[model samples]
Target chain A: MPATSGHAARPEASGPTGEPFLEVDRASVQYGSTKVLSELSLGVMRGEFVALLGSSGCGKTTLLRTIAGFMMPTSGSIRVGGRDVTRQPPDRRGMALVFQSYALWPHMTVARNIGYGLKLRGKPRQEIAARVAEMQALLGLEGLGERKPAELSGGQRQRVALGRALAISPDILLLDEPLSNLDARIRLTVRHEISALQKRLGITAIHVTHDREEAMVMADRIVILNAGRIAQIGTPQEVYNRPSSSFVAAFMGAENVVPLLVEAGGERLRIAAGPVNRAAAIPAEGRRLGGRVVEARFRSEAAELHSATAFPKEKATEDALVLDGVVMQASYPGGVWRHVVKIGEATIVVDSSHAFASGEAVSVKVPAEALFLFDATDCKEGEEELR
Target chain B: MSVLAETAAPARAAAWYWIPRAVLFGLLAFIIFGPLVNLLLWTVTEKWYFPHALPLEYGFSYWGRVFSPRGNAMGSLGTSALVACLTVFLSLLLAIPAGYALARLRLPFRSLILLALLVPNAFPNLPIYVNIARLFYQIGLNGTILGVVLVHTTHGLVYAVWIATAAFGAIEPELEEAARSSGASAFRAFRDVMLPLAAPGLMASAIFVFLESLDEFTGTFFVGAPDVTTLPLLLYTSAAGGNYQIASITALILLVPSIAFMFVVERFLRADVLANIGR
Candidate 1:
């Protein structure tokens, strides 16, 4: 897929009579005195996989549980396919959740576990058996039906959980960090399995995960949550390339941030060179550069390093923000060498193919499009930026 | 040379290891089977003096007499079985939901409530039995089978609640949530998921309650004397009246339910159910 910039994927015009499949409007959940979700609103289109991505305690799980009808919003309504199900119980919501722990019934055999929902719906024994067989084959779990969950491997158990959820053929599927418990090797395989199954079934799925790459690779749109509110909601490429806030920028792997001075020029913003940086200008369009002092953030991989003495004869590119720094420490991390470069008082990590010795001076070139600029005062306390 | 040494060393080590194990087995056998052997001999003895090392004669007369219609043994055994079954039923009925609540719900002073469930077992039985006797008398339930069953159920309910609480607590709440999300109603989820997962523990608790109620003596004696005669009370009264052979036979009879319960517990009441539930 070609990368889109700075815009959420537009809801399909023909999506089920022009309405979003699932709508969470102004929903807030309060636990005793503490509010976990504050007036959160989101719209998911039919067949769209929207990921609620956040660190722990960000209320992403709370929002997903609310949509699944496991939790009731203190106020506001949740409408699924044009029906308000805010006060409905989880069983009546016609949704299935693949739990993080793969919560298979330990006492039940694999077939029985997958058929539990069908049995609850009062389907005939034979029909339940048939559907269970079909699900077993679908998840590549043939000949393993009689085995209990404790007898199965982690990946097999995860597939059984998926099969169980899909057995009911619910309108929407909810995933709660379903891959978090698997080993790294198995997690990648199962992650693709879940994504492929969701796409093949065309089921509208809402996946909740703290892993950024998992959400980026799996979801059509990603909702980045911070402090019980959405920091930004956009496609993975848009959120990664053009984050709306410093928090989103930092969370999207832009951990190297440095303060810079800027002045609005005709059709461009002139960046003032500090004691450690060289002056440059970038187009002002689509940038919220109201203040003079702004935080310039870029990913470690986005910055290219050149030796201090080996100056190129060509002038500096208009789009590249060049900064001079002395390498304080260097380490080889696999294919690339990572260095801790000290620029004025701020230290940043820059990755380069070539290793630079410690205390060696170097020039770092960060392209204009790769540099995310946010207001200087927007920096939160205790935020870890230099990684 | 190393292989020879390894083989020789383990043989010597095995010889030394049997010493403590042998002593432990000898003590366990003596502690457990000693009284049982004496009881078995007593049931068949015709007569024996107190200082005699062995019975002077052996006969089947006491066994015959106990099985006879005049002995009232069968009636008392029947009463004991009925009371135990009733106690098991009532205790389980009350404990399943109570245990679920204690394990999963946000009750005020939950630990204190659980501690209170254990209060009956901790105190001396005499005061509790006296209080129960008084309460039963006022309610016109004294000297009746229902009253004895009620008192015995209270005796068994403590263990039922404790075992069921641990069993239900071992279950991951996420399993029930998974069921509910997969279109199982709360009741269906309990029946299909939680109940089956917790069946072994529940069965263990039920058998425990049954055994406890069957062996209950103080409350049954105090509340059920002269009318509702269960096996333990029968054994106690028979022995007090100096019918030693009949008392031994009755004691043997009492062992039936306990032995049967132990068999069931060993066969099904796995100790590792909690540890292995979500693994």
Candidate 2:
């Protein structure tokens, strides 16, 4: 990894205020012999919503908890506004966490749950009450002050959890998949509400979630973690369109893995003729392609389906991957017709407007822009460990 | 199935269901209230012969005699109440922290430690108390209120520690973490979230210790015989002296508080409160 990625992996991304408010300087966490979180360095700017995106056991939660001061980082320090707080307790750290389960005090009403932090700080009774009311109104929890957590619906409980986190007015808000408990229909509404609320308050937030779309829709920058190390950290556009590694490409919905043999080049790489794919050349002036054997991944919607009988030999020279295959099955999933195409021994999914019969031979043409290629030898070790 | 249900189900269900239910209800009512009725009769009976089915004379005079300041009954009741309270206090003081550790920490010998808590009850308590009394006698703790309280605490702690551990175990650990992230110190988090969540269970445990101490006779007699006069000890003496009325009144006194504690526990440990917290 480069020094820039080791220190600040984000590619020139800036928050609304253009200032780094929270800095996790090489924080690492270990559980006995196994390292759950390797040295992870990230600088979250002020008023920015940074999402740590990963699947389960990817150390995203550990990173969030370490930032929240619940877990101690084994080596590095965490800083907020240039103040070292690695040794501080969760209470002393200026961060409030909205737990996945909401974790509302069952003995207390919504009003008290929101006001609990204020009470702990020994704020004046009227001030705490006023702040609690304001938070409730901000989160649209009006007329639910006296209701216990059990009485509230899932969405309402989620808002109450958000309101409680906001009431403290901490420097950073830490969210641990708070919307995961909500139904899919309600999750969308809460997602937008949380994003808008964070922007409206201009408070920095670090959200931990495994939901790719949720992270894309809510965060200013997505920090994709894999195997306790940061695989990629960039804006949603950057990570989705220009992933750093094959692991990230597969994680970001590019599940169709196609192996290819390419010769390294400056402007255009010559894709060698293989058993599954034809020889072609793709633009590569800016891309960091290497090695003879390359792994190519494309999303279901990224590839085009066509008839294989009409072989366009001249199209191979263009900036696109042409794979010959036969359609195995097709399904209408809402608008697009999804087809399962068998390209030799490997099967891949491609979505097109028109449906192809099961036995019909097809061609999958993945454009260079939509196709993610990484060196097979460089990422083969990580590929087998992937879920 | 349809033929059986249509033809034979109703009569069989009625007979079998109602008959057993009625029998169980009768048995439960008798088992629960039968002793209380007998105690009531004994409290009011002024005079009775061996052959008499009921008390020949019933009056409120025994109640009056029981409440009299000069009567050992009132003083013994007070002593029993104090001893029970002290026992509960001491037992919980040890149980709460120990229970929290047992429930939350990943200790090496968790099951072994839990088994050790039951050690005081595992063996015959009579011989244990006899040895305890002998040790106390040498240490000058025998025949004092402290001696009786210490003795009762040994018994009280068995239930207290186990219940407290279970109570803490029943609460979600996330509640404490939530409190901590909400700007509460570790102690404050336990006091605010963990303690409140586990209160009902701990309350039930405390009530168990209280009742155990109030009715404790063997340990109390062995450790505090000459100086301490708890209601149970007083009842024993009164019964042995052939004063059946005083003994019955003392038992009644003991029963009132036990019933009251049960009611309190029921109200505190209502299902709705636990069902909704952090789920």
Clashing pairs in 2: none
Worst 10 residues of 2 chain A by lDDT: A1-10
Q: Pick the candidate with the highest DockQ.
A: 2
Interface root-mean-square deviation of model 1 in angstroms is 0.9
lDDT of 1 at B54: 98
Clashes of 1: 0
Tens-digit lDDT track of model 1 for A27-74: 899888899999888878789888999999999999998998888899
Tell me the deviation in Å of residue A231 in model 2: 0.9
Reference-based TM-score of each model? 0.90, 0.91
Interface Cα RMSD, each model: 0.9, 0.8
Cα-based lDDT at residue A378, candidate 2: 54
TM-score of chain A of 1: 0.92
